[model samples]
Structures are given as structure tokens and as C-alpha cells.
Target: MTATAVNTTAVDLEQPLQDVESCLNLLGEALHRRDSAAIELHAASLHLALAQAIEQFTAAARNGTVPASLRTRLMQAGGRVAAQRESLARATAALDRAIDVLMPGEPTGLYGASGKNERKSAFGGSIQA
Candidate 1:
């Protein structure tokens, strides 16, 4: 039986991570413009794109099509993006908490206690306390 060859070369994950960063920067610009709708709309698409890029990089590395430097870069980029993602998530959570504290009663609000409707919508519980 003939054995199949496996490519062990790593892909450069940095380029895609850089792309992600650029996308994020664009998103920031959109936010700076107070384009809430635009930011919200693009955020998901940007996230998906970054994820796909990472996936492609990893796959290329596994397939041995990626060069050593590219592979290292890909790994590094993945780590960087992971860190950035965590930071963003934490910051977002903090911001939400702050908003919750500040607003305390808006269902459709971003930072607040969340209206009864939101509680119900998310947790299926009434906010009658």
C-alpha cells in the first residue's frame, strides 16, 4: 500500500491577522463617525473574514504548502488575534456592565440594567423584582 504524503510546512498567519487588524481599524473609523449601524453591520462580516483567513492559514500549514516563515507568522498572527479578541471581549463586557450601571432600565439600550423585555428575551425571565 502506498502511503500518502503530508505537508509539514507552516503557513504565514500574520498577513491575515494584519488584514484583520486593518478591518478592525476600518471598523474603528466607522465607530468614530458614529456610524453605529455601519459598525454593527460590518463587525460580523469582519469577524467571519478574519476567522476564515486564520483557517486557511492553518490548513495551508498542515498541507505543507506554507513556508517556515509564513507558518511562524501564521502561528504568531493567530496568537495575536486570539489575544486581541480576548481583550476586545473583555472590554466589551466591561463596557456593557458600565452601561448597565449607568442606564439601569433600558431594554433596547447598550449599557444598562436591561429592560424587562431584554431579560425576558435573553433569559426568558421577568424583571419584576
Candidate 2:
């Protein structure tokens, strides 16, 4: 292929990588603010874009059409995506552990009174399980 054609293809491939980066940035913002909906949307979009770009890059590499610079960029982006997923999984597991530690029991409202004298307190309400 001509140099101009190869350059154009490289530029086209870069667009999707750029899109994935922007989506990841948005997802990070949403996660920081605990915006669940925005986080889900951005995460899904980023995943899709990254997957598509990886497929394209892999196909080009197999055909010996992808330039060395583009191959390096794709590999770097793939590494970043994998690292992000690992970070997300770790954060989720930490949150689960925190919730378990903080609220670790069924609500048993027994205001220190005997069963016979278990008259309800005015300020406390029983939450029936």
C-alpha cells in the first residue's frame, strides 16, 4: 500500500482508541461521584470500543498491514484496559468487605430487657425480619 493510504488507516484506527480513552475518563469521573448510571454507560461504551479496536488491530497485524507504531499503541491500550478492569474488581471486592464489616447482623431490637419485660422503648422501633 502507498504511504498515504497507510497513514490514513492508522489515523482511522487511532480514532477508536481515542474514543475509548475519553469514555474511560468519563467513567472514572462517574465512579468518583458514585453516579451509577453514568458509570455503567461509560464503562459499557469503553469496553465495546476497546474490543472493536483490538479486533481490528489483531486482524491487521495478522495480515502484515498494521505498522509498528500502531501495533505498539494497540498493545499499550490493551494493557491499560486490563489494568483498569483489575482495579475495578479490587475496588468492588473492597466495598463488599466494608459493607459486611459495617452492617454485619440481622436487626434484633432487644433493648437489654428480659423477654418478659421486653416492652418496647419509645425511641426504638423494631424492624421485623
Highest lDDT model number: 2
| Cα-based TM-score, every candidate | 0.45, 0.67
C-alpha lDDT values of all predictions: 0.61, 0.76
Clashes of each: 9, 0
Q: What number of backbone clashes does candidate 2 have, counting pairs of residues 3 or more apart or in separate chains?
A: 0
Cα shift from native, residue 129, model 1 (Å): 23
Model 1 lDDT tens row, 1-129: 112222322224555656766766676676557576877766776688678776877676555555556556546655755764676588789999999899886455534454323333455765556
- Can you write out model 2's per-residue Cα lDDT over 24-94, one digit (the tens) per residue? 77877887787889978988998898888877777666654877777787677667778777878998999
Give the lDDT of residue 4 in candidate 2.
83
Error of 2 at 80 (Å): 2.3
The reply for model 1, stretches above 4 Å from the true place, is 1-21, 24-42, 105-129
> CA shift at 40, candidate 2, in angstroms?
0.6
